[model samples]
Structure formats: structure tokens, C-alpha cells
Target: MSDDMLRLLPWTTPDGKPCYLSAASDHSRLSLLADDVEAAQLDSGEQVLDGARAVLGDTKAGERAVRFALTRATESLEDVLRIAVSRGERIEAGET
Candidate 1:
């Protein structure tokens, strides 16, 4: 398959390797599922960012609270970054 038709999925393997999808078409079943997953990930990332900001702004946020927020923010950042790379590749490949 051509690079234009291949897509980097929003998730990874059990061992932390990246996942990919060889979409048959724009509206393929797997492609649509991936789109849904990506959308959810993006939304979750936004929520995590907001919560992290709130935690940071809190004058009395304890160590545990700050740590938890930071951890969640880190995970969200990873997801968002992967999404960016995936989308960027698609655009560059003229698949957008």
C-alpha cells in the first residue's frame, strides 16, 4: 500500500510500540473507528489540560494532588503529540 493510504493509529501495542492502520478508504470501518478514538483522545486531552492548569493555580494543592495532575497531564500530552504527528503525516501525504 502507498504511504498516502497508510495511517498511524492513535494508540500503541501492548509493549508500547506504535500502531498503524492500512485504511482501504477514507470511510473504511477501521478508519472510522480510529477517527472516533482520536476524537475522544483529543477531547480527553483538553480536559486534562484544564484540570492540570487548575491544579497548578491552586495555592494549597498538596504534593499528591499536584503529582497526580502532572501525571495525567503527561499522559495527555503524549496522546496529543501522537495525534499531531499522525495528522501531520496525513496532510503531508495529501490524504487530508
Candidate 2:
């Protein structure tokens, strides 16, 4: 990965899962996970491949699989106010 790609922006999906967006050569991909998605116990790609092959039914599926978890967080007063300012006017009572 290049330096530009390494600079990720932490975010969350609509379902509330923690995630990060990173730029790639061919695409921009997002990973939603419980912890630091980039830091895995397996340091080397080869090690990951070997372990995955043993556990997963298919090596390809294992390679493609990603782990993630949904979470909720409390917003600070400032953040709440900022959010309210941004969208407070757009919302209409009883309109979902």
C-alpha cells in the first residue's frame, strides 16, 4: 500500500458497524470491523493464506471474507449540537 492509501478515514456504516475508508489503486474500498481492521495477528500474507486454507472450505472464500461488528457510541454535547444544526431544519415531525 502507498502512503496515500494508508491514510484512512474512520467512519461507520448505516447499520452502525465501525469502518474505515481507504484508497486503492483500482478502487476505494471500505472495511467494517470491530477493531483496527488493518492490524491482524498474522503479520505476513503467506501466513494468513496458510491458516485460511486449513480452516475455510475454499481458499478464495477465506481470502475474500472480512470480519465486522456493529456498535453504538454516545455523542458529545458539541457533536449533538453540530448534528442538530446540520439536519435540524431538514426533518419534519412525524415524517420518517
Candidate 3:
């Protein structure tokens, strides 16, 4: 099947394995669940960004606090990028 038939879900399995659904319809139950998870992740990432900025801007924030904020921000960004890349790849394949 073409890569376009594969959809990436935001959340992983119970065992922490990445979950991917192979189907042509984006309106399927699994697809809708994935969409919901993606929306939650995006919202979480935004919160992380805001908190990270606050921590960075605070003069009294300790190194450990800043480090933790940065770490969380990095992880959130990575997840967002992975989702974007997966969608982008499918789009690119479709255009070729």
C-alpha cells in the first residue's frame, strides 16, 4: 500500500509502542481518535511553550528549573515535528 494509506496516531500503545493505522478513510473511528490525540498534544505543546518562556524569563529561576522546562519543551517540539513530517511525507508522495 502507498504511504498515503498510512496514518500516524498521536498517542502510543499501552506498552509505549508507536501506533499507526493503515486505511484510506480519515473519518474512521481510529482516525478520529488519532485526531483527538493530536489536538491534545498540540494544546499541551502550547502550554509547555508558555511555561518554558515564563521559566526562562524569571531571573530567580534556578538552573534545574530552567533545564527541566527546556527538556519538556524539546520533547514537545520533537513530537510536533514528527507529526508534521509524517503528514508532509504523505502529501509529497501524493503530488509525485
Candidate 4:
């Protein structure tokens, strides 16, 4: 994967734990924490994996979504931070 893809979603672990991933030239991964279910609405490994596959999916689709959202090659770092914070808040609030 290119730097742009890395900057887009930023691979994470399945339990919402943050982890570094190699370039996604072939595959992509995201992690979720057990506690994220109460927030993000993703409860199981299957759910997490499915969600990742749906949203992140293959390179072409992922790149397209990112580009459409950001209207640029890179996803805004600030947006990523905001999303993380919002998800955390949702969990804390029991909104998920």
C-alpha cells in the first residue's frame, strides 16, 4: 500500500487496540477491543472482521472511499483523532 492508504484508515487491532501494520499492498487489518461493542456496536471478532472487510475491504475500494471523503489523497489526521475520541465517548456513554 502507498503512504496515502496508510494515512487513510491506519490499521488497528481487532479489539480496538492500536497496532502497527505493514503496508496494505495485499491485506488490511483493524483491531477491536472487547469494550468497543458498547460503543461502536461491533461486539464479536466476526463482527469486527466483517466491519473491516466492509469498510476497508480491498485496496481499490478503500482508496476510493478515502479519497471521496477527504477529497484528497490523504485522510485528515484530525478526522482520525476525532473519530477515535468520539468512539471512546460513545462507549463511555453506553451509546453503542
lDDT of 3 at 16: 68
User: For residue 75, what is the lDDT in candidate 2?
Assistant: 24
Candidate 4 structure, TM-score to reference: 0.22
Question: Judged by TM-score, which candidate is best?
Answer: 1
Instruction: Indicate the TM-score of model 2.
Output: 0.20
Candidate 3 lDDT tens digits, 3-39:
3567667766899677778877777788788778777
Candidate 4 residue-wise lDDT, 17-94, digit = tens: 554423534233332432232234323333544545565655567665645544421223433454566445445544
Candidates' C-alpha lDDT: 0.87, 0.33, 0.80, 0.41
lDDT of 3 at 85: 68
Which pairs, if any, clash in model 2?
A: none
Q: lDDT per residue, candidate 1, 20-75, as tens digits?
A: 88865768788789889999999998999899999999999999999999999999
For this target, which candidate reaches the highest lDDT against the unseen true structure? 1
In candidate 4, stretches whose alpha carbon ends up further than 4 angstroms from where it belongs are 1-75
Q: Is candidate 2 or candidate 4 better by TM-score?
A: 4
Q: Lowest-scoring 10 consecutive residues by lDDT in candidate 1?
A: 1-10
Q: What lDDT score goes with residue 16 in model 4? A: 57
Q: Residue 36 deviation, candidate 1, in Å? A: 0.6
